[model samples]
Target: MSSKTLISVVGPTAIGKTRLAIILAKHFKTEIVSADSRQFFKEMHIGTAVPSAEELKAVPHHFIQHKSIFEPYSVGDFEKEAIAQIEKLFQNNDYVVMVGGSGLYVDAVVNGLDEFPQIDSKLRDSLNQKLEKEGLECLQEELLVLDPKYYHLVDIHNPHRVIRALEVCLTAKKPYSSFLNQKRKKRNFNSFYVGIQADREVIYERINQRVDIMIEAGLLDEAKKLYPHKNLNALQTVGYKELLEYFDKNFTLDFAISEIKKNTRRFAKRQLTWLRKNKNILWVDFNTEPKVILEKITNQLKTNPHA
Candidate 1:
């Protein structure tokens, strides 16, 4: 068995996942490969919550802010890129850290993605027209009816994710969830999952606080700068989406910020929902000290050396 292992640090947003990942990276003297799809765009910074400059310098990081909002990037593209980066890093270290709240991207790196049948472009275009005619919630409701399992797990606010799932469901005449985990492809390195969780109240509070901090840190100005490109796929994320709606004069600024907090809490709930389905991850309390968590991880590494 290969000794190399990828420690995937996953949790809801504002749960200190980056802190834990950095500690592990330092301990292993290794690098980190980010799987958060939102952090991939160069145009989005404060809204996506890219790591602080000091954090990036503390350890070498990859796949963060490496692309433009205009460039087309998908989970499949990320899976390929992350695997290649991990292979390169594994040449010098036995363990590398992968951290992100984006469960699909993290899972794609750990368990190879299921092969999706080719979706018809016209069908996708039709969905887009429907989205335009109605709104994001229209397609979100349709997806809930078609695939509740995925509907609960996905960011229903993301038009791309919702429409993509709908396209597959409509084409295959089955729940999009049914096609997942059909097979787990083999990889050269083992994977160990570490998840952090907190009480619901605690998680929501943190998310609310984080949103306020982002606002104070000039999130509105950043969103204003990207207002022209709000139609881009990368701008379809949570923090930026609500702000973009504000730019469209859909509501008051205060209401927009509140919506950001509300939507972010819902997003975190969905994140936990998707993450809890994986039985292999060793979940730790969000407030657990770094040394204690590190001790648990090291113990697992020693006990299950090959896994």
Candidate 2:
């Protein structure tokens, strides 16, 4: 068994992963490494729903607001950087906490990223141009036709994912699903997954309320500030994209707010779907108190120290 263990806190958005991660880190006297993709971009703080100033002070965190929207980052880059960071942290502490709702990012750290054959740079550029010309719907449709299984599992609304799948199909002469199903590389440290779950209605309610709070905290202004860069991949997230439509006069404020809530609820559903497929996860219901949750982890850790 490895001496160092990684504790991952995963769940749908608004299920309190951040709060639970902080509590776990404090108990274990360790730091946190955020796996949230959106939170990596410094310009997207408000729309990304990053942890508050108090939360940051509670425990040191890595990978939060460390990148620019213009920078190109891949899961392979994240795997290298996050594993290096975790190794550095493990030199000081045996256990470290990682928290996020992004399945791809979390999977990258735990399972290692998949290796894809390199395509010509010109081919990639051509695909990107076609995406901009014909819109994401065209790319999404092609991805669905090439890799239905990945289409079902991936974030369909995510243009990057669609483009990536199309890239695999065009370059490899095989469906992207074929490569995705290949064996995942192993990791050095033991990973203990702690998942938080709630009833659908309850989870949806929390997502809706969180969106309302984000609006109250000036999400509109934040989106407006980035309106000029709405075409950037970083700004394609839920909170910003909807508000961008509002700026384009495509929708009223009320309509935009409703769409944010609706899309967030859908996102939560997708998160649950992704998490449930992982059998290694040990799930705890949200109805349990935080102290109770901590006790459960503590007891489990005592029995299985290497977990």
Candidate 3:
């Protein structure tokens, strides 16, 4: 039997990754393992742009809404669980699909996470205090100054991410980017990347439309329900954060919605920045037919049987 392969469908949000992954999984008669970190929480549905009920029914999906927001699910946890799930799936099928926009979680499963030295607890506490007192911009600015490369690739609006990178920079006196991809751990299965690409204007339009659809589907109500737990790491995302600002009277609802669209675009840009660094990815037009994409993937696999 051939060694198992992991087909990672990666792209910016709202670029139709879910649809493409489902098509590929169905073609391969396999299941999907979601790497979208925000989609892991059950409480965050519409905001995370999780697969619709119809889409989920079209293919068996693992890791989507499999955890609660109250739980502290780190990238390491996701990497372990995702690998276990993929291994189990490979027992039944030769190929399994992994899809998401969260580059860190995806890399955790693909390249393995880079190990960092343990910083002092006091340093974390001090950073948290600074974040709470001075705001995310303060931390973001510091990160940009300390590690401009990582700043371009990271979700700047995420405080947890910003603070984590800053902690490494401050402690090690080195740019956080310096630690990444220094060494890659071997995996049992072969990995293939399929990146969906589109024109910048088209991608932004798709994101704006998706945000509008989410609003129509009651994203505000969903955000309101999760607002009380806004401080939680899982809730510190694009849609929820903007809505929480409205709930806090810091911005009008109209302004908040616009902010969500703007921030989501920025998030997509960051995702593309991270993905572009991977020169091995097989880029395809976003509108390419599923059958064509599948054929391309299969041909690549055949030509590089040892990959």
The candidate that wins on lDDT is 1
TM-score of each: 0.98, 0.95, 0.98
**Clash-forming residue pairs, model 2:** none
Off by over 4 Å in 1: none
Per-residue alpha-carbon lDDT of candidate 3 for residues 18-104, written as tens digits (9 for 90 to 100)? 999999999999999999999999999999989989999999999999999998999999999998898889898999999999999
Error of 1 at 189 (Å): 0.4
Enumerate residue pairs that collide in model 1: none
| Best-first order by TM-score | 1, 3, 2
Q: What C-alpha lDDT do the candidate models reach, one value each?
A: 0.93, 0.88, 0.92
Report backbone clashes per prediction. Answer: 0, 0, 0
Give the top-scoring candidate (TM-score). Answer: 1
Cα displacement (Å) at residue 299, model 1: 0.8
TM-score of 1: 0.98
Clashes of 3: 0
Quality of model 1 by C-alpha lDDT: 0.93
